[model samples]
Target: MSKNLADLNSLEERISALEKIAENFKKRAAEIDEKGEFVYENIADLKNCGYTVLTIPKVFGGKETSLYDYIRLQEVIAQGDGATALSIGWHMGVVRNMYENKWNPKVLAAVYEDLHAGALINAAATEPQTGSPTRGGKPQTKAEKIGDKWVINGHKSFTTMSVVLDYFVVSASIKDSEEIGNFLIRKEKKGIRIEETWDSIALKGTGSHDVYFENVEVEQEDYVETLGGAKRVNPWLLHIPACYLGIAGAAQKEAVLFAKNYAPNSITGTISELPSVRTKIGELELKMLQAKYFLYSVSKKWDETKEEERELLLPQLSAAKLVVTNTAIEVVDLAMRIVGARSLSAKSPLQRYYRDVRAGLHNPPMDDMTIGQLANFSLNKY
Candidate 1:
């Protein structure tokens, strides 16, 4: 077997190794959240593990793990720290998308090389004027063709991983054209800087700040894709819902531990022995199981699906994301109830989980949009 394929055969072993490394992230998660600082050390640890380039194809000297493998690893990382997991998810998803789509050959080669060297990338599409790109909002940022360069000027909001990104795949309206192109901008380039503007109550350590660009120049080859391209069902995006489910897993663990050990004077045994507590725990487990099965089953289907048949599964994919993310929020809430008032303490990780899971509701494939799409899909199918 090829070395890369052979390595993938040992995914469980590799995941075990990653789990050990995640311990340090779990240990430092509270501190990172409390300080509201970027998880630089976590990123460094992931890079050292060759995770930063996991999405680059094997030909480019990367692991080129499948979407399932990537989702599994992301869930493991999220179990330790949701902010770190979410921050890195952008990089992993972007790289995987580039590899799968094979954009401009020259640009892809450069990005692959950078990925090998531990570079991170995220699509800078959301702007102050337009909320989510999925909502079909045109970018306010504009890219103009100069003598031999494309000069870009615009601002992007919620630029996740801004503190650690080496490149940004930004969306900009083409000057004098109706087209909106995704431009690749380097971090060290002049006139591109991250503004300290993110002050969200959740995902506090994601470094998702406002990014500004004024006359940032790049070659024409840097523009990856024009907006309004044919849409495809993106299975890799399942990593997002997976991350929140991981956070819920952490909260569940904490709650179970508390229920097993905290025996009050009024009870004959620990709270876990109480019928009411057991019912809540059962409900939590059932919901989690359903969401996970939906996620992984759909992910596996995507892996085996023919390219032409993939678009037919868009409703299922969106439904999985919506179900898993919404279930994650409720799972965290139930976990907190299991832990009672102690879950509210700053020292408890449940509070962090509660806040972090809510961010998933705002992620792409938004709940309302997904519901509307599902309704349309059902009517059309009938």
Candidate 2:
């Protein structure tokens, strides 16, 4: 683990640099998708640019990026490469959790160092039997306290960036106790292996695979967070929608470019001359504007609001995720229609965008669940 010169410049400069770097990934992104390989180069680029530790608090030798700033940068990255943006978003979000003092002092110190060194950590809470831990299913993974170390064993699904993660925050039930905790395990330890199980057509380069832990030993203090009761919607997690929104933006750009220049032998002019094509573009723009307002305003609200007030904003956050993700999907569909059959060709990105945007529908704070929660709130108020 080493440190880079803290490029303590203006936030705008930092964001602009990252956006430029992301733009460079477009070709690489297509290659990664075609090969169905991990976006290893993309992660390495982010690390080299010192973007990996941007969220660590200033006091802990990081840029201390604001939640809004984080989302804004992620959108830029996603616009260029959705899989890379998504893979790193999990790392950025989980590391930001440390700012809330969620981990013990010793653990926090070690984590800060690891993160600054460009290490990635993700919460491996999704299990085969329990699905997403957010659904309140008990984890089949168990940890036993033997002497001074905690021995952990279990399987995790959808471990995004498993190939590059240096550490994992794994949730496990204590051997004898009813309590569950998040154990921090280093990747170098024995008994930890990546299962290479992810074969999804969407986000093919994310490298989200199954990980198995067999008798992995961790220090007592490594159990950082208890798998406690339900928690409030984290405003930082808005990065999820930010990623999808970027994908939508990319699709819109592709469609607009094609419309502006595509002249056919049978047509009198380019597609941009067609009223229907213009209308679809207009719709995409309107939806994007609405989604951006919803996302940024709520994110700003989260930053300004007190922690207690933040808990009550679950509906707004959930709505932002639902609206943005749905809007992204629609935008991609429109892009595909505008581009016609060519959009579906493997050479075109619109098809990939269509597939990737749909994954957002399955992300946490699911559409149906959000609607139900909103209805529950409205009914109680009414």
Candidate 3:
């Protein structure tokens, strides 16, 4: 088979397996959200199915899933449970980026081994004071070279998958220097504690708790990479939009199901027959198509572009994120409109989808920044 056809076949097989796992996730998603508990079992299911290691480099004995394929997998998982998909998306995307960027060889080897053994990892960069790392916030998390080991001390906010992650790629300022470096810290390290502070109304099951590192130490080899100023366009970040799109997909499914069955005394048949409801559904489909096309097209471009040339695609990448994330929010809103007031019910999945989809607005490549980049690109090109 051709490479593209082989990849397609592989993706189909993987997605089919994920669909079965996602069905179980869908059953418990509401409860997991209601309790604001981490989707431990859902994550375990992913690990058991070897989905966690699919993005590891092929040299590392992984499937080496393409960026487009990974995003599709994330969307599928999100349709099952947005929280689980969002949480795991971080691990999957980070793994892909880390390998593609070629982090410290020894460190990468070790992490890959752990990944193959079902370990999960995510970057812990957001801090209470510094805010999102995307805004060039120097981490308050400090790492000091204490003899042969580095002692890391600080708190990280929004450490998603905190309850389940075996490794944390923490960004910290190097003590007594202007440099910031990312350190790979194992969860089993001493002086590390999780503060369950993720109380957001969105993606509650994400377990985005605060992690405190009071004198946590790691070997010198764990000091993976120094932070750099240039913002390289990372295609793996597309997983974020894929996740929200998946949540919107779930909302669409629920709205359609409700419309096809919900009959009002004012109507002769189900609400699906109503023109207004049909219009909303049509709008949902339009937005979904727009978002999916934008997301997948950009991802395909990223996969096809050479490493040096990929940097030039930053504007397009950010635009894709901007379009898809905003469209996802709108799609969920339309779905809720189709479902009416019952969509706001605490028991309804639409409510959860609404909250989860809104969280995408807070993800990296914020809409305003994306617009600014597009404007700059146009002005410079002209």
Candidate 4:
């Protein structure tokens, strides 16, 4: 094992290691975006650095990083490459949720072992028919019980990290029942295939391909949890905004650097000295500061709050995601304005950041749902 991988025992060590690798990620960011190719090397680097297992419980031989630290780590990774950060964030968030919410222990153990062995995982929930799962649409995917095995047949869309995931917790409707369940399907299972269907302009390297399960069989025990179970708050979803915030941070850096160096004949000095440029930079800083405080504060509160009290935090959690994600988009826009037309150049990182940050809007807990929830809560409370 590499020395960096061995030293990932604490949050600080992991952060340091991620920072070291992010420079290399930045160098390849444009190429990955241009080709819309998944950077397998970036994923490998994350695994080699032990970041892939950061959310697993300590008893499972993992880092058990706190929610706050996990968000911080994600932000740092996003600074280098938003696509890589977003792709990996799904794995991290899913793992954290499983452990926190207590998924099937046996399955969790088996998956943790795979994670230690450089395997990745993510939920395959969204489907072409259901649209965003957040809208409470029943999955079109169907699972049938055949003897001791359950045969799953369905197509899952937006399966992030599809190319590399070792396991997919697929949501499917149980045949002959009104029930929906998440089945833990291994990648090596027979009758499983991935269709390279992802072609989004934003976060193009996420490799969120379409996965088909035709007569895929799993042990009944692999049926992990029922869908639409009592809703429990998930603070880990904040990783979504954390990823975008990191992209915005990268954009902010690019803008600052460009302003400090690019001297136009019309200016006495570099534009960094211009009041207008300074104002935009200041606005960028303000937005980022607000976003960081909101994200980190909520994550910290989640870490400190009791499990039973966590349900009450749903509104705040959704608000944090909403505020931070929108703030990140605004920050990137301001950053591009600071850099002028050159920011849109295919060679410029700002263009990539601009495109990547927009993906956060489409992530879980949609803006409309969050707003409606907040309104409901306010009306009831008052």
Any residue pairs clashing in model 2, and if so which? none
Cα-based TM-score, every candidate: 0.96, 0.96, 0.96, 0.97
lDDT of 1 by residue, 224-294 (tens): 87767786567778889989988988888888889999999998989999999999999889988998898
What TM-score quantifies how close candidate 3 is to the native fold? 0.96
Off by over 4 Å in 1: 1-8
- In candidate 4, how many clashes are counted? 0
Query: Candidate 4: which stretches are off by over 4 Å?
Result: 5-10
Off by over 4 Å in 3: 1-9
Cα lDDT, model 2, residue 127: 90
Candidate 2 regions with alpha-carbon error over 4 angstroms? 1-8
Cα lDDT tens digits, model 2, 243-304, are 99999999999999999999998889998999999999899899889989999898888888
The prediction achieving the highest TM-score against the true structure is 4
**Global lDDT for candidate 4?**
0.89
